[model samples]
Target chain A: MSAVIEIEGLRKTFRSVRHGKRVAVDGFDLLVEAGQIHGFLGPNGSGKTTTLRALLGLVRADGGRMTVLGEPSPELLPRVAGRVGAIVESPQFFGNFTGRRTLRLLARAGGVSISRVDEALELVGLRDRGDDRVKGYSLGMKQRLAVASALLKDPRLLILDEPANGLDPAGIREMRDLMRSLAAAGVTVLVSSHILGEIQLICDHVTIISRGRRVAAGRVDEVLAGHDRHEFLVRVAEPERAVDLLHEAELTAAVEGTALVVSGVTDPTVISRVLGEQGLWVGELTPLRPDLESVFLELTGAGEHPSVPRQVDDSALPAGADDAAVIDLDVRGVDA
Target chain B: MNLVRAELERLSARRFVQLMVVLLALAFAVTAATTLAGSHRPSEAELSSARTQAAEALQGMEATHQQCLARQNSMTPPGETDDFYATDCSEFDPIRQDRLPIAADYLPGVFSFEQQARPLLYFLIAFLVLFGFLVGASYIGADLNSGGVVNLLLWRPRRLTVLGTKLGTLLGTVLALAVGASLVYLATFWVIGQTAGLGGRPGDDFWRSLGAIHGRGLVLVLLATALGFAIATLGRHTSAALGAAAAYTVVWELGARLVLEIVDARRPDRLMLSSHIAAWLNGKVRFWDNQLCTSSSGTDPCSGFYSLTWGPSLVVLLVITGGLTVAAFAVFRRRDLL
Candidate 1:
């Protein structure tokens, strides 16, 4: 399948009188396949937004080769712009214009049908407030309106940057489902966000970037597997003895609460066999596959530097997600 | 086409512009009404005063001619054109040669339409240009302040096309408004003239002059509007353009005039932008009051204003406006939107 967005050797530098020269994106590369919801994850001040801006020709890149929907970008941006929808940073709009009027202006500029304005507003659940002026809209409503704008063209490729920034829980779920539905209908989606759980739940493919460089990228599971240290949580009668025996066997193991967690060994039966030979009965031996958050933190070195603030706060974790497991592994991963 | 339509919509939708239009129409009506009310048939006393003054002037000229003729006959025969008697006789013949009209015994029975319309036309031209500048500046200023340029460019990324369309839309709107306002002024002035006993019916010559006035009025409106747009584009903010315009008009022109007077360099006043603009609007040639007029060369013609012809006046005005426009487009095309 052809890639929807291709970036090779992309570089961007910004020079400000107050800040001197700072590199925003350096030697960055990205490939997003067609018909998939791809997650673009990065820490604060990373090049995620910068890369997206360069791709859309909002800012001219210092050096790069980029393509969107199989056409060379920025040079041919106008040709393909009609079929690509994007919301960069935050949505900017005319305050006096009604929500419906704003979309009509955009639709007219893009040569899209006027009827699509209403259709897009309906799609984003903003149909009722379409007649109100944009200045009266709340932040969430404005975000919804921005989504409606992107949907007006019924684009083949959708790029959103922190689309869930100001959304509540319900709004975020709606946005996630909308992205999933768009991708399911054969549209390629590239979403950049700090919400790791949302990205894991909605994205079939993920690309993790750090410090203006791509550290890991692939299918969601493949990226997880490449960085996954097969950890098994075993609850045995003698948890401390189990950890000691696994350590004596040259395997990385540790005790957390009442269970012993072992990594660097994939065979679950060997774990039971070793503990069983020592006259300790295993109550539970469940494989602890790394979630996207753990894999992300591991890959981006957020796990290595505990003091550096993480993009995903503990409060942003989705309900029923394993916060304890994430913290436990991060601590152990630091020691290892 | 889309960009032009969008710009027109955006410009017309502003509430400030709408309020300005209403206020302008009200102001025009009041001015026309007040001017007409004060311009009525002259009173009997005023007529007698004007006639007495005209008779005195005619009587004085006749007496002077008689005295010069007596002196000419008493002096030596004319030897050359420069001799005292010859010079006095040469000046006397022309003064007494043309027949002067008889002093009017009564004032005009009605206010003249041409007299009433000229001031009204000047009023329209001045206000229209001033207001046009504000409109043009505000149109771009609001967009820059609100960060709407980025949003608009996202839909159409051709930078030059966006700026060109905006300027075209502004020029078209200002020109249309100016023409419409002039028509209203003319219609109101004509009605008042007829109501006040001045004939409203205009001759072909009147029509021609009126057309020229409106034509020049339109050019003035265009130049002012373009100036505002260019300044706003270069500065990327409305206040900056407004501040610059105010400074040029108040500080630059007034300061330059004061400096020229202090230094006794009045000849260079012909090149002043304000001077040319004023001359163009008044349909008069601008002049420099050089000290050569007061020199001891004994040249009679040197004791008056030296006319700056229409050609140079128009050229200077266009050069200033055109240079600003080109600079604006260049900066807009190359500068980063941020």
Candidate 2:
């Protein structure tokens, strides 16, 4: 697939008399191919918005190169701007203008047919309230209007920063569906949001950024698979005995509440066979896979504490065997 | 062209511009009413009384002239002529009928379009200048402050083109409004004169002079509007333009005038912006300069006058407008819109 957007070694720094200098985006690199709904995930102040702004020419960049649809960004951005739609931040409109009037003005400015204004409004489910003044709309409705504006040109590439901001659960689902429909219609969407769950649900590809740099990026499942530990949750009537049996067989196991978590196991039959020989029949054995949230938190260091080191809990081990059967797995970070 | 059309539509839709238009209409109405109420056609009896009073005043003036001539001819010093010992007799010249004051002139008789409309035209021009400045400032100021400019840039990525189009639209609209408003103002006053006072036809020379003044007024309004837009664009907020205007007025107009007075500066009015504006509008204005004296005595203080003409005033205004506009455009082209 052809790359729709490419950013290489992009850097931007903001300087002021009071704040001195701040590196908002540092050597950040991103590549989005055509027909992919890419999710850009980051915490607050992680340079997600800065990268988007720099790419769109809203702000000048200090270093590196960026391109949109094979044209160098900010300079040649206008050439392809008609084919691309972007909303960098929460754009506020004239409060006195009706929603329809606002869209009509944007449509005229962009040289798009005015009929698309109604279509964009319908796509975002704002057609009914299109006549209402913008000041009277709720926050979610405003967000929807912003989305409607981005969809005015029926763009091939859509860049939205925090598109789900101020959206209710239902509205978020509607937005998700709208994105899915757009993607199905051959549009490449690059959506940045703090809502990792929504990103996991809708995006085919994901890029995770932290401290103004990309920490992880790939297909959602592939990124998750790199963090997967092949661990399993084992439940039995005698969890302590199961831990002892599993430890004797050279399997790392820790009793967590009512179940013992087994790690470093290549095959599931080994755990059942090792436990059944000693009359310890496992009631349940479920394989635990890593999700995007855990991997995102781990890669972004969101779960890291400054003053403390992560360690496996010795209290969860059997009483007398704690010294010899200590599992070296640092699961505290995952638990956090 | 499309962007220009959109901007014009947006400008017209602004509540502040709408309010300014309403105020302009109200001001025109008030001026017309005041002009109608202040003028009238004098009666024949009043004319007869004015003639009688002129005869009595002329008789008294002739008696004073005879006394001055006798004093000058008889009381001359040896070394000096009548110039030193007594007043010059030539101060009293051949009295003419026009020199005598008419009652209709003193009272609010017929309103002469040639004589009375210039000052009122100045008022109209002043109001329009103020209107243009404020509307131009808010036009771009509100957009930059509210991120509306950013929204427009997202649609049209050419920064210079967007800013240039906005400036062009502002200047064009101000010119159109000034022309339309001036026409209406002059027409309404003419109607008022015809209905309640004299509507004497003015000669071509008078209309030509008035037209020239109107042209200058239009230029001034355009310049003021551009200045406001440039300052607001540079500051990225409406309050910045307003603050700059207030600072100039208080510091330069009022404060510097006092400072210049204390220092006894020569041609102090030459250093003032208001004086330049007045000169530009009125062709030329004379200011009293007591320091520019050629001769003085013990009792009489030294005094003279200085005049500010149109050429220099136009240059100063153009330089300010051009400099700020260029700066605003350069900064806008490079600065990051946060």
Top TM-score model: 2
Docking class of 2: acceptable
RMSD per candidate (Å) reads 8.3, 8.1
Model 1 Cα RMSD, 1 decimal: 8.3
Residue B261 lDDT in candidate 1: 79
TM-scores for all predictions = 0.81, 0.87
Model 2 spans > 4 angstroms off: A305-336, B37-39, B46-104, B109-112, B294-302
Interface RMSD of candidate 2, in Å, is 8.0
- Compute fnat per model: 0.22, 0.73
lDDT of 1 by residue, A1-336 (tens): 888999998877666565445665667799998898999997766577778878887667889899988888778877888888888767778878999999998887667889999999988889999999999998888999988888888999999989898889999999998998898899999999989999999999988776566777899988888867788898998888888888777888899998888988878888888888899999998888889888876766578657866552221222343333221111101110
CA lDDT scores, all candidates in order:
0.77, 0.84
Angstrom error at residue B336, model 2: 0.5
- TM-score quality measure for candidate 2: 0.87
| lDDT per residue as tens, model 1, B1-338 | 77777788888988767877887898897886676766665556766676687788777767666666776566534543333333355345535453453323234544556655767787788888888888888788778656677667666767677788888999999899899889977887777667763443767877787788788878988988888888887877888779998898677688877887788884766757777776676566646476755674542324345666555667777788789889988877655454
